[model samples]
Target: MEPDAARDIAVTDRAFFHILQLAGFTGGTENLMKLGEMNWPDIRDLDKERLVAVYPIASFEQHGLHLPLLTDTIQLDAMVESMDGKIGDRIVCLPTQWLGYSFHHMRFGGSLTARSQTHIRMLVETVDGLIGAGFDKVLVINGHGGNSADLRVALQELKETHAETRVYGASWWGVAAPALDAIREAGPNGSGHAGETETSMMLTLRPDLVQTDRLHPDGGWPPSVYAGRVEHFRRIDEHSSRGNFGDPTVATADKGQRMLDATVNSLVEIVDDILGERL
Candidate 1:
Protein backbone atom coordinates (compact mmCIF):
# COMPACT_ATOMS: atom_id res chain seq x y z
CA MET A 1 0.00 0.00 0.00
CA GLU A 2 1.11 3.56 -0.69
CA PRO A 3 2.31 5.47 2.37
CA ASP A 4 -0.08 8.08 3.73
CA ALA A 5 0.67 11.68 2.79
CA ALA A 6 2.68 13.40 5.50
CA ARG A 7 0.77 16.03 7.40
CA ASP A 8 1.62 19.56 6.46
CA ILE A 9 3.87 21.20 9.06
CA ALA A 10 3.62 24.72 10.36
CA VAL A 11 6.11 27.33 9.25
CA THR A 12 6.94 27.71 12.93
CA ASP A 13 8.65 24.75 14.59
CA ARG A 14 10.61 23.87 17.75
CA ALA A 15 13.63 25.88 16.54
CA PHE A 16 11.35 28.81 15.78
CA PHE A 17 9.93 28.53 19.31
CA HIS A 18 13.39 28.52 20.90
CA ILE A 19 14.35 31.59 18.91
CA LEU A 20 11.13 33.24 20.01
CA GLN A 21 11.99 32.47 23.65
CA LEU A 22 15.38 34.09 23.23
CA ALA A 23 13.71 37.06 21.61
CA GLY A 24 11.15 37.37 24.49
CA PHE A 25 8.61 34.54 24.50
CA THR A 26 8.89 33.98 28.26
CA GLY A 27 5.72 31.97 27.76
CA GLY A 28 6.07 28.29 26.88
CA THR A 29 5.27 26.70 23.51
CA GLU A 30 1.81 25.67 24.63
CA ASN A 31 0.26 28.93 23.32
CA LEU A 32 1.59 28.61 19.82
CA MET A 33 -0.31 26.63 17.16
CA LYS A 34 0.17 26.12 13.51
CA LEU A 35 -3.60 26.58 13.33
CA GLY A 36 -3.82 25.94 9.61
CA GLU A 37 -2.03 22.64 9.97
CA MET A 38 -2.87 21.51 13.51
CA ASN A 39 -5.81 19.59 14.93
CA TRP A 40 -8.24 20.53 17.74
CA PRO A 41 -6.07 18.84 20.35
CA ASP A 42 -3.12 21.02 19.46
CA ILE A 43 -5.22 24.17 19.92
CA ARG A 44 -6.88 22.93 23.11
CA ASP A 45 -3.48 22.39 24.68
CA LEU A 46 -2.39 26.00 23.98
CA ASP A 47 -1.18 28.20 26.86
CA LYS A 48 -3.85 30.80 27.44
CA GLU A 49 -1.70 32.93 29.75
CA ARG A 50 0.81 33.84 27.07
CA LEU A 51 -1.43 33.96 24.03
CA VAL A 52 -2.24 37.20 22.21
CA ALA A 53 -4.05 36.14 19.07
CA VAL A 54 -4.32 38.38 16.01
CA TYR A 55 -6.80 38.23 13.16
CA PRO A 56 -5.79 40.06 10.01
CA ILE A 57 -8.92 41.45 8.37
CA ALA A 58 -8.68 42.42 4.72
CA SER A 59 -10.90 42.76 1.64
CA PHE A 60 -10.95 41.33 -1.84
CA GLU A 61 -11.32 44.68 -3.56
CA GLN A 62 -10.18 46.22 -6.77
CA HIS A 63 -6.67 47.67 -6.42
CA GLY A 64 -6.45 49.00 -9.96
CA LEU A 65 -5.11 46.87 -12.82
CA HIS A 66 -1.51 46.58 -11.72
CA LEU A 67 -2.20 45.01 -8.32
CA PRO A 68 -4.13 41.87 -7.44
CA LEU A 69 -7.54 41.81 -5.78
CA LEU A 70 -5.82 40.26 -2.74
CA THR A 71 -3.54 43.26 -2.18
CA ASP A 72 -4.88 44.06 1.25
CA THR A 73 -4.58 40.43 2.35
CA ILE A 74 -1.07 40.27 0.97
CA GLN A 75 0.00 43.37 2.84
CA LEU A 76 -1.49 42.14 6.11
CA ASP A 77 0.14 38.72 5.73
CA ALA A 78 3.50 40.34 5.10
CA MET A 79 3.05 42.39 8.25
CA VAL A 80 2.41 39.16 10.15
CA GLU A 81 5.56 37.58 8.72
CA SER A 82 7.56 40.58 9.82
CA MET A 83 6.42 39.81 13.38
CA ASP A 84 7.74 36.25 13.24
CA GLY A 85 10.15 35.24 16.07
CA LYS A 86 9.76 38.77 17.51
CA ILE A 87 6.35 38.13 19.04
CA GLY A 88 5.95 34.39 18.49
CA ASP A 89 5.23 33.44 22.09
CA ARG A 90 3.55 36.66 23.05
CA ILE A 91 1.35 36.77 19.97
CA VAL A 92 -0.19 33.97 17.92
CA CYS A 93 -1.00 35.30 14.48
CA LEU A 94 -4.25 33.82 13.28
CA PRO A 95 -5.20 33.23 9.69
CA THR A 96 -6.12 36.27 7.57
CA GLN A 97 -9.78 37.32 7.15
CA TRP A 98 -9.67 37.42 3.37
CA LEU A 99 -13.05 39.08 2.92
CA GLY A 100 -14.37 42.34 4.32
CA TYR A 101 -17.06 44.98 3.80
CA SER A 102 -16.17 46.57 0.49
CA PHE A 103 -19.48 47.88 -0.83
CA HIS A 104 -17.63 50.81 -2.31
CA HIS A 105 -15.94 48.49 -4.75
CA MET A 106 -19.06 46.55 -5.65
CA ARG A 107 -19.30 48.04 -9.11
CA PHE A 108 -15.80 46.94 -9.89
CA GLY A 109 -15.27 43.46 -11.17
CA GLY A 110 -13.93 40.83 -8.73
CA SER A 111 -14.86 42.85 -5.63
CA LEU A 112 -16.39 40.83 -2.81
CA THR A 113 -18.08 42.62 0.06
CA ALA A 114 -20.29 41.97 3.05
CA ARG A 115 -22.89 44.48 4.22
CA SER A 116 -21.98 46.55 7.30
CA GLN A 117 -24.49 44.85 9.54
CA THR A 118 -23.61 41.42 8.20
CA HIS A 119 -19.91 42.08 8.61
CA ILE A 120 -20.37 43.20 12.20
CA ARG A 121 -22.42 40.13 13.03
CA MET A 122 -19.80 37.91 11.41
CA LEU A 123 -17.02 39.60 13.36
CA VAL A 124 -18.89 39.23 16.64
CA GLU A 125 -19.53 35.56 16.02
CA THR A 126 -15.94 34.98 15.00
CA VAL A 127 -14.61 36.73 18.13
CA ASP A 128 -17.10 34.91 20.31
CA GLY A 129 -15.85 31.62 18.90
CA LEU A 130 -12.25 32.64 19.61
CA ILE A 131 -13.16 33.56 23.17
CA GLY A 132 -14.97 30.26 23.50
CA ALA A 133 -11.68 28.64 22.50
CA GLY A 134 -9.94 30.29 25.53
CA PHE A 135 -8.19 33.33 24.12
CA ASP A 136 -8.44 36.20 26.57
CA LYS A 137 -7.09 38.93 24.36
CA VAL A 138 -7.80 39.18 20.63
CA LEU A 139 -6.53 41.79 18.20
CA VAL A 140 -8.41 42.47 14.99
CA ILE A 141 -5.90 43.89 12.53
CA ASN A 142 -7.91 45.49 9.75
CA GLY A 143 -6.50 46.34 6.32
CA HIS A 144 -9.49 47.86 4.57
CA GLY A 145 -10.99 51.29 5.25
CA GLY A 146 -14.61 50.34 4.64
CA ASN A 147 -14.67 47.82 7.49
CA SER A 148 -13.43 50.30 10.13
CA ALA A 149 -16.70 51.58 11.59
CA ASP A 150 -18.38 48.19 11.65
CA LEU A 151 -15.30 46.60 13.21
CA ARG A 152 -15.39 49.15 16.02
CA VAL A 153 -19.04 48.41 16.72
CA ALA A 154 -18.39 44.67 16.69
CA LEU A 155 -15.45 44.99 19.05
CA GLN A 156 -17.47 47.12 21.45
CA GLU A 157 -20.29 44.61 21.48
CA LEU A 158 -17.89 41.68 21.86
CA LYS A 159 -16.19 43.32 24.86
CA GLU A 160 -19.56 44.01 26.49
CA THR A 161 -20.80 40.48 25.98
CA HIS A 162 -17.53 38.79 26.92
CA ALA A 163 -16.20 40.95 29.70
CA GLU A 164 -13.42 38.50 30.49
CA THR A 165 -11.85 38.82 27.08
CA ARG A 166 -10.59 42.10 25.63
CA VAL A 167 -10.84 42.76 21.91
CA TYR A 168 -9.00 45.55 20.10
CA GLY A 169 -9.52 46.64 16.50
CA ALA A 170 -6.85 48.59 14.62
CA SER A 171 -6.40 49.60 11.01
CA TRP A 172 -3.00 48.71 9.55
CA TRP A 173 -2.70 52.17 7.98
CA GLY A 174 -3.51 53.91 11.26
CA VAL A 175 -0.98 51.77 13.12
CA ALA A 176 1.80 52.26 10.56
CA ALA A 177 1.42 56.03 10.16
CA PRO A 178 4.88 56.96 11.43
CA ALA A 179 6.61 54.39 9.27
CA LEU A 180 4.52 55.37 6.24
CA ASP A 181 5.58 58.97 6.75
CA ALA A 182 9.22 57.97 6.63
CA ILE A 183 9.07 55.76 3.51
CA ARG A 184 6.39 57.62 1.59
CA GLU A 185 7.04 59.32 -1.72
CA ALA A 186 4.88 62.16 -3.20
CA GLY A 187 4.15 63.08 0.40
CA PRO A 188 2.20 61.05 2.96
CA ASN A 189 -1.15 61.99 1.42
CA GLY A 190 -0.49 60.14 -1.82
CA SER A 191 -0.49 56.75 -0.15
CA GLY A 192 -4.15 56.13 -0.83
CA HIS A 193 -5.61 53.02 -2.56
CA ALA A 194 -3.23 51.35 -5.03
CA GLY A 195 -0.93 54.31 -4.39
CA GLU A 196 2.74 54.56 -3.57
CA THR A 197 2.80 52.96 -0.13
CA GLU A 198 0.53 49.96 -0.76
CA THR A 199 2.02 49.32 -4.18
CA SER A 200 5.46 49.51 -2.67
CA MET A 201 4.58 46.94 -0.04
CA MET A 202 2.98 44.64 -2.64
CA LEU A 203 6.10 44.94 -4.76
CA THR A 204 8.12 43.58 -1.86
CA LEU A 205 5.71 40.93 -0.58
CA ARG A 206 4.53 39.53 -3.91
CA PRO A 207 6.63 40.86 -6.72
CA ASP A 208 5.28 38.18 -9.04
CA LEU A 209 1.74 39.42 -8.46
CA VAL A 210 2.60 42.97 -9.47
CA GLN A 211 2.52 43.94 -13.12
CA THR A 212 4.83 46.95 -13.28
CA ASP A 213 4.22 47.30 -16.99
CA ARG A 214 0.63 48.32 -16.25
CA LEU A 215 1.66 50.78 -13.54
CA HIS A 216 1.32 53.91 -15.64
CA PRO A 217 -2.11 53.06 -16.99
CA ASP A 218 -3.26 51.81 -13.61
CA GLY A 219 -1.82 54.82 -11.77
CA GLY A 220 -3.84 57.28 -13.83
CA TRP A 221 -6.75 57.51 -11.39
CA PRO A 222 -7.28 60.93 -9.72
CA PRO A 223 -7.90 61.12 -5.97
CA SER A 224 -9.56 64.55 -6.18
CA VAL A 225 -12.55 63.11 -8.00
CA TYR A 226 -13.71 61.23 -4.92
CA ALA A 227 -12.25 63.36 -2.15
CA GLY A 228 -15.32 64.49 -0.18
CA ARG A 229 -18.07 62.00 -0.97
CA VAL A 230 -18.69 58.48 0.28
CA GLU A 231 -16.74 56.22 -2.04
CA HIS A 232 -19.56 54.00 -3.24
CA PHE A 233 -19.19 51.63 -6.19
CA ARG A 234 -20.83 53.82 -8.81
CA ARG A 235 -18.91 57.01 -7.97
CA ILE A 236 -15.58 55.19 -7.89
CA ASP A 237 -16.01 53.65 -11.33
CA GLU A 238 -17.14 56.99 -12.72
CA HIS A 239 -13.77 58.47 -11.77
CA SER A 240 -11.50 55.71 -13.02
CA SER A 241 -12.03 52.62 -15.07
CA ARG A 242 -9.35 50.66 -13.21
CA GLY A 243 -10.74 51.36 -9.70
CA ASN A 244 -7.53 52.86 -8.29
CA PHE A 245 -7.28 56.16 -6.42
CA GLY A 246 -3.68 57.39 -6.55
CA ASP A 247 -0.45 57.08 -8.52
CA PRO A 248 1.22 53.68 -8.27
CA THR A 249 4.03 54.46 -10.71
CA VAL A 250 6.38 55.52 -7.94
CA ALA A 251 6.08 52.23 -6.03
CA THR A 252 9.19 50.12 -5.43
CA ALA A 253 9.81 46.74 -3.78
CA ASP A 254 12.56 48.16 -1.55
CA LYS A 255 10.24 50.86 -0.23
CA GLY A 256 7.55 48.22 0.31
CA GLN A 257 9.90 46.07 2.39
CA ARG A 258 10.81 49.01 4.60
CA MET A 259 7.16 49.98 5.07
CA LEU A 260 6.24 46.37 5.89
CA ASP A 261 9.07 46.17 8.44
CA ALA A 262 7.93 49.39 10.01
CA THR A 263 4.30 48.22 10.11
CA VAL A 264 5.18 44.96 11.89
CA ASN A 265 7.53 46.78 14.28
CA SER A 266 4.68 49.10 15.16
CA LEU A 267 2.41 46.08 15.69
CA VAL A 268 4.99 44.54 18.05
CA GLU A 269 5.04 47.73 20.11
CA ILE A 270 1.27 47.83 20.24
CA VAL A 271 1.11 44.19 21.36
CA ASP A 272 3.74 44.86 24.02
CA ASP A 273 1.84 47.86 25.31
CA ILE A 274 -1.41 45.93 25.42
CA LEU A 275 0.20 43.05 27.29
CA GLY A 276 1.94 45.42 29.73
CA GLU A 277 -1.24 47.28 30.62
CA ARG A 278 -3.61 45.96 33.27
CA LEU A 279 -6.95 45.09 31.80
Candidate 2:
Protein backbone atom coordinates (compact mmCIF):
# COMPACT_ATOMS: atom_id res chain seq x y z
CA MET A 1 0.00 0.00 0.00
CA GLU A 2 1.26 3.54 0.83
CA PRO A 3 4.94 3.93 1.79
CA ASP A 4 4.22 5.13 5.31
CA ALA A 5 1.68 2.36 5.82
CA ALA A 6 4.14 -0.15 4.38
CA ARG A 7 6.82 1.13 6.75
CA ASP A 8 4.44 0.94 9.69
CA ILE A 9 3.52 -2.62 8.85
CA ALA A 10 7.17 -3.50 8.46
CA VAL A 11 8.01 -2.01 11.84
CA THR A 12 5.15 -3.74 13.69
CA ASP A 13 5.17 -7.02 11.79
CA ARG A 14 8.28 -7.74 9.78
CA ALA A 15 7.71 -9.21 6.32
CA PHE A 16 9.16 -9.34 2.81
CA PHE A 17 7.87 -5.79 2.26
CA HIS A 18 10.17 -4.74 5.09
CA ILE A 19 13.10 -5.82 2.97
CA LEU A 20 11.75 -3.79 0.07
CA GLN A 21 11.27 -0.79 2.33
CA LEU A 22 14.75 -1.17 3.76
CA ALA A 23 16.06 -1.31 0.20
CA GLY A 24 14.32 2.01 -0.48
CA PHE A 25 12.15 0.68 -3.28
CA THR A 26 9.11 2.16 -1.55
CA GLY A 27 10.60 5.64 -1.85
CA GLY A 28 9.87 7.08 -5.26
CA THR A 29 12.73 7.01 -7.75
CA GLU A 30 12.78 10.83 -7.82
CA ASN A 31 14.16 10.71 -4.28
CA LEU A 32 17.34 9.02 -5.47
CA MET A 33 19.44 11.92 -6.75
CA LYS A 34 22.98 11.32 -7.83
CA LEU A 35 24.76 14.68 -7.77
CA GLY A 36 27.21 13.77 -10.52
CA GLU A 37 24.33 12.69 -12.73
CA MET A 38 22.32 15.87 -12.18
CA ASN A 39 22.55 19.40 -13.54
CA TRP A 40 22.20 22.59 -11.52
CA PRO A 41 18.45 22.72 -12.10
CA ASP A 42 18.15 19.08 -11.14
CA ILE A 43 20.14 19.69 -8.01
CA ARG A 44 18.06 22.76 -7.18
CA ASP A 45 14.89 20.75 -7.65
CA LEU A 46 16.26 17.79 -5.70
CA ASP A 47 17.45 20.10 -2.98
CA LYS A 48 14.48 22.48 -2.93
CA GLU A 49 15.42 23.46 0.57
CA ARG A 50 18.66 23.28 2.52
CA LEU A 51 19.85 19.66 2.37
CA VAL A 52 22.65 17.58 3.91
CA ALA A 53 25.31 17.36 1.22
CA VAL A 54 28.12 14.82 1.58
CA TYR A 55 31.45 15.74 0.03
CA PRO A 56 34.04 13.02 -0.44
CA ILE A 57 37.47 14.58 0.13
CA ALA A 58 40.47 12.60 -1.06
CA SER A 59 43.99 13.14 -2.32
CA PHE A 60 45.95 11.87 -5.29
CA GLU A 61 48.79 10.44 -3.23
CA GLN A 62 51.16 7.52 -3.47
CA HIS A 63 49.78 4.27 -2.00
CA GLY A 64 52.79 2.09 -2.66
CA LEU A 65 53.30 0.01 -5.80
CA HIS A 66 50.21 -2.15 -5.44
CA LEU A 67 47.50 0.52 -5.21
CA PRO A 68 46.93 3.44 -7.57
CA LEU A 69 47.42 7.04 -6.52
CA LEU A 70 43.66 7.58 -6.61
CA THR A 71 43.04 4.91 -3.97
CA ASP A 72 41.69 7.34 -1.41
CA THR A 73 39.25 8.91 -3.82
CA ILE A 74 38.11 5.51 -5.02
CA GLN A 75 37.39 4.27 -1.49
CA LEU A 76 35.60 7.49 -0.53
CA ASP A 77 33.45 7.37 -3.64
CA ALA A 78 32.56 3.75 -2.97
CA MET A 79 31.59 4.63 0.60
CA VAL A 80 29.30 7.37 -0.71
CA GLU A 81 27.72 5.00 -3.19
CA SER A 82 27.12 2.40 -0.51
CA MET A 83 24.98 4.90 1.38
CA ASP A 84 23.10 6.05 -1.72
CA GLY A 85 19.75 4.29 -1.35
CA LYS A 86 19.71 4.54 2.45
CA ILE A 87 20.23 8.28 2.87
CA GLY A 88 18.66 9.40 -0.39
CA ASP A 89 16.22 11.86 1.16
CA ARG A 90 18.22 13.10 4.10
CA ILE A 91 21.46 13.43 2.15
CA VAL A 92 22.99 14.00 -1.26
CA CYS A 93 26.47 13.14 -2.51
CA LEU A 94 28.62 15.77 -4.16
CA PRO A 95 31.26 15.12 -6.78
CA THR A 96 34.40 13.78 -5.11
CA GLN A 97 37.25 16.24 -4.40
CA TRP A 98 40.22 14.39 -5.87
CA LEU A 99 42.84 16.71 -4.45
CA GLY A 100 43.63 17.42 -0.80
CA TYR A 101 46.39 18.54 1.56
CA SER A 102 48.96 15.81 0.92
CA PHE A 103 52.25 17.59 1.55
CA HIS A 104 53.65 14.55 3.28
CA HIS A 105 53.32 12.58 0.06
CA MET A 106 55.27 15.17 -1.95
CA ARG A 107 58.50 13.18 -1.52
CA PHE A 108 57.14 10.51 -3.84
CA GLY A 109 56.17 10.65 -7.49
CA GLY A 110 52.51 10.65 -8.65
CA SER A 111 51.45 12.50 -5.53
CA LEU A 112 49.60 15.77 -6.16
CA THR A 113 48.96 17.81 -3.06
CA ALA A 114 47.78 21.36 -2.54
CA ARG A 115 49.35 23.65 0.00
CA SER A 116 47.53 23.32 3.33
CA GLN A 117 46.32 26.90 3.22
CA THR A 118 45.22 26.52 -0.38
CA HIS A 119 43.38 23.32 0.47
CA ILE A 120 41.62 25.03 3.38
CA ARG A 121 40.65 27.96 1.19
CA MET A 122 39.35 25.64 -1.49
CA LEU A 123 37.22 23.74 1.05
CA VAL A 124 35.90 26.99 2.51
CA GLU A 125 35.03 28.21 -0.97
CA THR A 126 33.40 24.90 -1.78
CA VAL A 127 31.21 25.07 1.33
CA ASP A 128 30.37 28.69 0.54
CA GLY A 129 29.43 27.69 -2.98
CA LEU A 130 27.24 24.88 -1.64
CA ILE A 131 25.51 27.22 0.77
CA GLY A 132 25.04 29.66 -2.08
CA ALA A 133 23.41 26.81 -4.00
CA GLY A 134 21.03 25.91 -1.07
CA PHE A 135 22.82 23.24 0.96
CA ASP A 136 23.17 24.44 4.55
CA LYS A 137 24.38 21.25 6.22
CA VAL A 138 27.62 20.07 4.67
CA LEU A 139 29.20 16.76 5.64
CA VAL A 140 32.79 16.34 4.54
CA ILE A 141 33.79 12.69 4.09
CA ASN A 142 37.55 12.93 4.16
CA GLY A 143 39.74 10.02 3.06
CA HIS A 144 43.17 11.40 3.76
CA GLY A 145 44.66 11.92 7.20
CA GLY A 146 46.65 15.00 6.17
CA ASN A 147 43.53 17.06 5.31
CA SER A 148 41.86 16.62 8.73
CA ALA A 149 43.38 19.59 10.50
CA ASP A 150 42.87 21.97 7.59
CA LEU A 151 39.29 20.85 7.13
CA ARG A 152 38.55 21.38 10.81
CA VAL A 153 40.02 24.88 10.72
CA ALA A 154 38.14 25.77 7.54
CA LEU A 155 34.84 24.42 8.89
CA GLN A 156 35.28 26.28 12.16
CA GLU A 157 35.82 29.49 10.21
CA LEU A 158 32.76 28.78 8.10
CA LYS A 159 30.64 28.24 11.19
CA GLU A 160 31.91 31.48 12.71
CA THR A 161 31.24 33.41 9.51
CA HIS A 162 27.90 31.84 8.65
CA ALA A 163 25.87 31.06 11.73
CA GLU A 164 23.10 29.42 9.76
CA THR A 165 25.32 26.83 8.11
CA ARG A 166 26.81 23.78 9.83
CA VAL A 167 29.74 21.76 8.54
CA TYR A 168 30.94 18.39 9.82
CA GLY A 169 34.05 16.47 8.78
CA ALA A 170 34.98 12.83 9.36
CA SER A 171 37.50 10.45 7.88
CA TRP A 172 35.99 7.33 6.33
CA TRP A 173 38.63 5.02 7.76
CA GLY A 174 38.57 6.67 11.14
CA VAL A 175 34.81 6.41 11.44
CA ALA A 176 34.85 2.76 10.43
CA ALA A 177 37.14 1.74 13.23
CA PRO A 178 35.06 -1.23 14.23
CA ALA A 179 35.20 -2.61 10.73
CA LEU A 180 38.88 -1.75 10.46
CA ASP A 181 39.48 -3.65 13.66
CA ALA A 182 37.64 -6.62 12.29
CA ILE A 183 39.81 -6.50 9.21
CA ARG A 184 42.87 -6.18 11.39
CA GLU A 185 41.86 -9.27 13.34
CA ALA A 186 41.79 -11.07 10.01
CA GLY A 187 45.41 -9.99 9.60
CA PRO A 188 47.58 -7.82 11.87
CA ASN A 189 48.04 -4.03 12.09
CA GLY A 190 45.74 -2.37 9.52
CA SER A 191 46.75 1.27 9.96
CA GLY A 192 49.28 1.76 7.19
CA HIS A 193 48.77 4.36 4.46
CA ALA A 194 48.50 1.72 1.74
CA GLY A 195 48.33 -1.16 4.14
CA GLU A 196 45.87 -4.00 4.40
CA THR A 197 42.66 -2.01 4.92
CA GLU A 198 43.34 0.51 2.17
CA THR A 199 44.63 -2.07 -0.25
CA SER A 200 41.66 -4.34 0.42
CA MET A 201 39.31 -1.40 -0.11
CA MET A 202 41.02 -0.46 -3.38
CA LEU A 203 40.96 -4.08 -4.43
CA THR A 204 37.21 -4.13 -3.76
CA LEU A 205 36.43 -0.81 -5.42
CA ARG A 206 38.82 -0.82 -8.39
CA PRO A 207 40.47 -4.18 -8.76
CA ASP A 208 41.80 -3.18 -12.14
CA LEU A 209 43.94 -0.47 -10.57
CA VAL A 210 45.71 -2.93 -8.27
CA GLN A 211 49.14 -4.08 -9.44
CA THR A 212 49.46 -7.24 -7.38
CA ASP A 213 52.83 -7.98 -8.93
CA ARG A 214 54.22 -4.70 -7.57
CA LEU A 215 52.76 -5.18 -4.10
CA HIS A 216 56.22 -5.55 -2.66
CA PRO A 217 58.41 -2.97 -0.98
CA ASP A 218 55.88 -2.01 1.68
CA GLY A 219 56.27 1.72 2.04
CA GLY A 220 56.67 4.14 4.98
CA TRP A 221 57.98 4.27 8.57
CA PRO A 222 57.77 1.16 10.66
CA PRO A 223 54.31 0.94 12.24
CA SER A 224 55.72 0.72 15.75
CA VAL A 225 57.43 4.08 15.41
CA TYR A 226 54.75 6.01 13.50
CA ALA A 227 53.61 8.43 16.15
CA GLY A 228 50.97 10.95 15.17
CA ARG A 229 53.13 13.97 14.58
CA VAL A 230 52.05 17.42 13.41
CA GLU A 231 55.30 17.75 11.47
CA HIS A 232 54.77 14.57 9.51
CA PHE A 233 55.95 16.10 6.24
CA ARG A 234 59.63 15.98 7.25
CA ARG A 235 59.56 12.20 7.68
CA ILE A 236 58.08 11.41 4.28
CA ASP A 237 60.74 9.99 2.00
CA GLU A 238 62.99 9.33 4.99
CA HIS A 239 60.52 6.78 6.27
CA SER A 240 59.60 5.02 3.04
CA SER A 241 60.83 5.00 -0.53
CA ARG A 242 57.47 4.39 -2.32
CA GLY A 243 55.34 6.44 0.12
CA ASN A 244 53.21 3.67 1.57
CA PHE A 245 53.03 3.32 5.35
CA GLY A 246 51.72 -0.18 6.13
CA ASP A 247 51.64 -3.81 5.03
CA PRO A 248 49.40 -4.77 2.09
CA THR A 249 50.23 -8.44 1.64
CA VAL A 250 47.20 -9.50 3.67
CA ALA A 251 44.61 -7.35 1.89
CA THR A 252 41.47 -9.16 0.79
CA ALA A 253 38.32 -8.06 -1.05
CA ASP A 254 36.02 -9.50 1.62
CA LYS A 255 37.59 -7.33 4.31
CA GLY A 256 37.37 -4.31 2.06
CA GLN A 257 33.66 -4.86 1.47
CA ARG A 258 33.06 -5.20 5.20
CA MET A 259 34.97 -2.01 5.92
CA LEU A 260 33.12 -0.15 3.18
CA ASP A 261 29.78 -1.31 4.58
CA ALA A 262 30.75 -0.29 8.09
CA THR A 263 32.01 3.13 6.96
CA VAL A 264 28.81 3.84 5.00
CA ASN A 265 26.60 2.77 7.88
CA SER A 266 28.52 4.93 10.31
CA LEU A 267 28.35 7.92 7.95
CA VAL A 268 24.62 7.45 7.43
CA GLU A 269 24.03 7.43 11.18
CA ILE A 270 26.16 10.53 11.64
CA VAL A 271 24.39 12.31 8.78
CA ASP A 272 21.02 11.31 10.18
CA ASP A 273 21.87 12.72 13.59
CA ILE A 274 23.07 15.97 12.06
CA LEU A 275 20.01 16.26 9.85
CA GLY A 276 17.65 15.37 12.67
CA GLU A 277 19.14 18.06 14.88
CA ARG A 278 19.01 20.63 12.11
CA LEU A 279 15.64 19.71 10.67
Q: How many steric clashes does model 1 contain?
A: 2
**Model 1 ranges with Cα > 4 A deviation:** 1-32, 217-235
Model 2 C-alpha lDDT per residue in residues 199-231, reported as the tens digit of each score = 888888888998887765354434555455534
Candidate 1 on 208-274: residue-level lDDT in tens? 9988888752333346767556544334566667777677888888998888888888888888877
lDDT to native, each model: 0.71, 0.69
Listed in order, each prediction's TM-score against the native is: 0.80, 0.79
| Candidate that would win on TM-score | 1
- Lowest lDDT 10-residue stretch of candidate 1: 1-10
Query: In the order shown, what is each candidate's alpha-carbon RMSD?
Result: 9.6, 12.8
Clashes of each: 2, 1
